[model samples]
Target: MAADKVPGMARIAVIGAGMGAMATAARLAVAGHRVVVYERAATYGGAVRRFERDGFAFDTGPGLLPLPAVYRDLFVKTGKQPLEECVELVQVDPSSRHLFADGTQMSLPNASRAGVVAALDEALGAGAGERWGDFLVRAREAWDRTRRPLLEEPLWPNWSVLADREPYPSVPHKKLLRTRRATTLAEVAAWELRDPRLTALLENHALAYGLDPRTAPAGAAVLPYMEHAFGTWYVRGGIGELARAMYERCLARRVEFRFDASVARIAEKNGRAAGVELDDGTVEDADFVVAGVAPGVLDGLVPGTALRGADEVPPQRGASSRLTVLLALRGGRPEEAAHRTVVHTPDREDELSRLFGERPGLPAAPTVTVSRPDDPALVPDAEHEAATLTVTVPSGLPVSESAVERVLGVAERALPGLRDRLLWHEVRTPADIAEATGVDGGAVPAPALAAADGRLLHPSNSTRVPGLFAVGGWAHPGGGLPHSGMSGALVAGLIVEGPEFRGSQ
Candidate 1:
């Protein structure tokens, strides 16, 4: 239950107890505001959820955390205790091992550009590393140009420039007589990377996010640049531990959370957000409201209300979702095993065609990401281990046994004897993700990109309705653990400092 408001403070109603909403509430509370979060689910985290059974734990959504600094900033601004004090972060060495169908393999070192470049050259070929290294250089350029407006600041008033601009300096390629710079990530991969393996390496970054490299803007190069620069990390127990820590942080700040409470409507008064109405018809009034929900759900909250202007970027739709298979292995994890291995599909064309084809269907042999974390907390004992395998697929479809088998088969290349382990496995489909996201297809949102006609950007934090704002993946800066967390910071900055707030320092 929320406490009675103080005379001098404003009451803020935060819809959904997801990462972004919780982060926003904590910050707003520390800023001397009264905040309450209403979540339909019984838990705090949204897609950042955990599944536990028989002493085994697995993160049902994103298995790894990137850009830890985003949460570091939140911890610094919200309280005295830092994020590390809440959860342990283990930097993944050889960040990822890739097993290409062509019988080639390479391991990328964590956060070391030179190490990665060297490793690639040694494993892929002498000059393959140079190509990837060069790509990273250009990717960094995109990151530098987009870091501020795409992440730190609110969606700009003239966001068209961001939409129109392709920040990644894609190399030029000759078509007939004229030379044209690469406009799509596919062109960048083909013209710059050159080698099939290098192209797979580059495109996999975008593919992992459910983005199609063929059409994903060249500005999407920032995706790989981020991993190469910041590094990949795993929480001690699971990625869900990060969510637990953030939830605790919000609670520490006295931000009230009402779980299992469904918000039926976003109460509006005088053309401004007043508060929310629950499913039980109980209305909670507040000075402002922040919605951390899917676009479809948000629109239903206020019928016929124009929450966004025509010129503004619309909420992203039809993004790709994931299919996860949680595996329980009977043996202990190998001490020297890399934490993550990506099994590249043998036929990239067949995979992409099935995923983005006229009639989307499951790939016969899909690329699979296999994660085997070494954390003891995830297994019942040292003798047992847990692994998770994931594949990107079109959202909102029912998964079949064949789909799970295909994903498992692809992962077997990395595990060698994956099925022989004889341990049980659980499957998570788009239907499951839809439950958390509230999207029709359980489609996961991608981070706001600088190009692709602004099709990749999300709606701004400040909405068309006064005192009403959007937060989380559905809003500016877009999705992913770090981006969602950053959205909270952006929303807090806008609300606390008003329109003049550029961004957090």
Candidate 2:
């Protein structure tokens, strides 16, 4: 069907007010549809939540954004003002500072391949940088090959093409005199990077997204490549500012928002989604219904409908979630401190084993990401600072005192005298995430990957039930700020341009 010939101005009922859902609402409204968004929470943004106290604010979701072009595209397509006009976008200068377990420190420059190589060579050794740089070159190849399929385009009907093909052009290595190619991110790190610090650097990329490097497809190399190529960015206030901007954009586009509105189930008519049934039993009807919810929630909303195709149902298991500790510090942030610091876990194997193994427990030294933005907006004044510590832990696992202590201990490496400087701290566990986002076990969705037998792929935007669409981190292209924004664009394209619309050009 052609874009012009598509049906006109149908009411679009969106199930959540998350970034993806808001993106879809803004775009659909721009396309002349009457859009209404129902959010169970009292506010929009979903997991992109902000915590403010005593004039200090903390973004509990993403600390920094990668591939910001996705949201830039959304703002351009939906409104008169650009995204930058709505929210200040600043490129994080040393994209990240890595504190390796062995006391090696490396600060990677944003968006510069050569700079990254130089920094690594200076910090990790001469040839170490060369090896990492070469690996990045190969990772670029993987990114080019899989970028369209895994991200921009809709999941193809014959997705097995993506599942069967490994896009990462792994270099052959002699393992005990036998030639082999790396299949997983872990193998890629070991075979190519060789150095333990380099391996940790590579694996940490996968682990941050809750993917086990041991099992993540080699195509997962794109994760770091993406950050290095596009650069990491921060909104002036916090990442949550992006969500607030999108919410304002949606409102400007005349998209209605219903907070404190829970969708009990999807209302179907003649085998197509007609609307949603609210928890209060109010039947709000629409021509198309878009669900920006987790897979489990979607399944419950439309029971009997095979949302996951026959072969795609993942085993009943809880996905990984994040543990965030927001700290209100008494002292000011140092001028020379990096915006983001990743403290590597002292024992990688043990950490991975405990988190992903049958028996789960907090690692003795779990990797922690500490964010100390220099922005005064996050502090009571120049004399105080707001910091956040994040670690990936198994979903549904209780946050114990030991776990909190471990996180604080690791973060102290970056912020010396952290305990003495801390005025107060608040821990946001998986339970908090579950309560806020409504995802089972508070499992954060990982970005869609190219291989691993479709194990890492999200469900298609279009479902078996006609007129029902899925958007957000839980849908096509999967999670992360960029992926969620892309999912929104894909869903809007599918609705506006019809199925013939392959994807964004």
Q: Which stretches of candidate 1 lie over 4 Å from their true place?
A: 1-8
CA lDDT, every model vs. true structure: 0.89, 0.90
**lDDT tens string, model 1, 1-505?**
2121223478999999888998899999999999999999999898889999888999999999899999999999899999899999999998999999899988999999889889988998799888888899999999999999999999999999999999999887888999989989989988999999988888899989999999999999999889889999989999888899989888889999999999999998888788999999999999889999988899999899988878888889789999999999888898988899999988999888878777787888899999999999999999888999999999876799988887887888888787888489989999999987687798999999987888899999988888888999879999988899999998887787778889966
Number of the top candidate by lDDT? 2
- Which whole-number lDDT from 0 to 100 does residue 99 have in model 1? 94
The candidate 1 region of ten consecutive residues with least summed lDDT is 1-10
Give each model a TM-score: 0.98, 0.98
Roughly what TM-score does model 2 have, to 2 decimal places?
Answer: 0.98
Across 136-202, the per-residue lDDT of candidate 2 in tens digits comes to 9999999999899888998888887888889999999886879999999999999899999999999
The TM-score obtained by model 1 is 0.98
